[model samples]
Target: MIKVGIVGGTGYTGVELLRLLARHSGVKLQAVTSRKEAGMKVAEMYPSLRGWVDLAFSTPEDARLTECDVVFFATPNGIAMQQTGELLDAGVKVIDLAADYRIKDLSEWSKWYGMQHASPDLVEEAVYGLPEINRAAIRDARLIANPGCYPTAVQLGFLPLIEAGVIDAGSLIADCKSGVSGAGRKAEVGALFAEAGDNFKAYGVAGHRHLPEIRQGLTRIAGVDVGLTFVPHLTPLIRGIHATLYAKITQDVDLQALFEQRYLGEQFVDVLPAGSHPETRSVRGANVCRIAVHRPQGGDTVVILSVIDNLVKGAAGQAVQNMNILFDLPEGTGLDIVPLLP
Candidate 1:
């Protein structure tokens, strides 16, 4: 069994990892660290995990993470980079659910995240953990930088077209909306119920951090630098991301067939039948990205809709997927959750 350690187990992503990994038959929960909540029983803080998680939150120093087979850093940006190199040297695989190593350009990452990277030497070593695109790399990687929630949905929606080179990459527009929970489990005025609820507005229009990451991925996919206008919005719900991607169709091949064939064997990416609309709720709580492709009025602009539970496919669930790949287990071993619907 794979011994697993999770750092920062108090946030939405951290607990989400706990909720999934706690029951993974192939994974043994080793340690979970939360500096502020150290010594608190995991179940006591998140009653939902009462029967599944018997471990208590420990300080990072007490977690003894290097003893585990794999350690997941669900901490804020700079925390993982500070300790990842040591853990890697100890032969423990590390996966960070933050922006620490996702952007290859250290300067770009620092500019957007507002902090200098702690381990620039390891930046190139950390694989970008988007399983659909980097599955083979993930299998051999000792370190991984999990993709952000918004980037996950947007990239998946635009990938097929980008790969096929059937879309005008320079004019790509990702108009996306995510649940309030995407902000993370925190006490911020923006995330407060009274502020975020009954409110529908966009933020980071000038420049969102996820923009560079998504652009970098698409550029890699297209084999050329691509221009993208990525605008992220906050919705009133709690756990999903809906990305409506727009790209100019440069070719006439069947749009539906393109998307379907591209994701034909991909278990987590479900291409809905033609003319179907994928709702965020349809993928809530599940590590699945449901997509629907359309060419409005048979026009040049192709609109692709993609949805995923931000905490699932976007963060924790995807982390577990990477873990399964690293351990040579079935990709869906611990992620076979049916999406929660109302």
Candidate 2:
């Protein structure tokens, strides 16, 4: 069994990782660290894992993460870079579910995240952990930088169009709406239920941190700097992201066929029927990105609707998917979970 340790096991993504890893047939739960919650029983904090996850929270220094086969950092943005190098040196594969190593430009990362990268040299070596796009690199990588929630949905939505060169890359737009959980399991005035309950508002319109990461991925695919107007909104829900993408069509081609063929064998990306509209709830609690391509009135623009559970496919679930790839297991081995419905 693959021994696994998790850093920062108190957040939503952290517990979600514990839930999934506890049931993985090929894994053995090793240690989970949470400085503030050290010595607390995992199941006591998250009753959802009562019967399965029997480990307790250990402080980072006491977790001995280097002894595990793999360690997942579900901590805040700056925490992973501080410890990933040591773990890598000890032969433990590292997957950081944060922005620590996603962007290659050290200066750009510092400017956006507001901190000096603790390990900039490892940035170039860390593979972007998007299975659909970076599967081969992930297989051989010792450090994996998991893509952010917004970037995952947006990139997957725009990938086929950019790759086929059927859309004007310079005018790409991603208007995304995410549930409050996307804010993380934290206490903030913005995330309070009474504040976000019935409200619908957009934040980060001028700029969002995910912008550079998304642009980096798209530019690599298009072989040029892609122009993207990314605007993110907060919806009055708890756990999903719906990305409505737009691009002016540059050529006439069967978009449905293109998307279908592009993701033909992809296990987690679902291409809905031609005129179907995918709902965020359809992918809730599952590591699947359901997409529908549309050309209203056969106009000059194409609209792609994509949805995923922000905490699942967008975070914890995708991290597990990356771990599966790093170990050469079936991509969906522990991620074949069905989406939760109302």
Which regions of candidate 1 fall more than 4 Å away from where they truly are? none
lDDT by residue for model 1 over 1-342, one digit each (tens)? 899999999999999999999888998999999888899999999999999999999998999998999999998889999999999999999999998999999889989999988899999988999999999999999999999998999999999989998988998999999999899898899989999899999999999999999998999999999989989999898888999999898889898888888898999999999999999889989999999998889989999999999999999999999999988999999898998878
> With candidate 2 superimposed using the best TM-score fit, by how many Å does residue 316's alpha carbon deviate from the native?
0.7
Clashes of each: 0, 0
lDDT agreement with native, every candidate: 0.92, 0.95
lDDT of 2 by residue, 77-178 (tens): 999999998999999999999899999999999989999988988999999999999999999999999999999999999999999999999999999999
At residue 90, candidate 2 shows an lDDT of 96
Span of ten consecutive residues with least summed lDDT in model 1: 333-342
Quick one: best lDDT, which candidate? 2
Q: What is the TM-score of each candidate against the true structure?
A: 0.99, 0.99
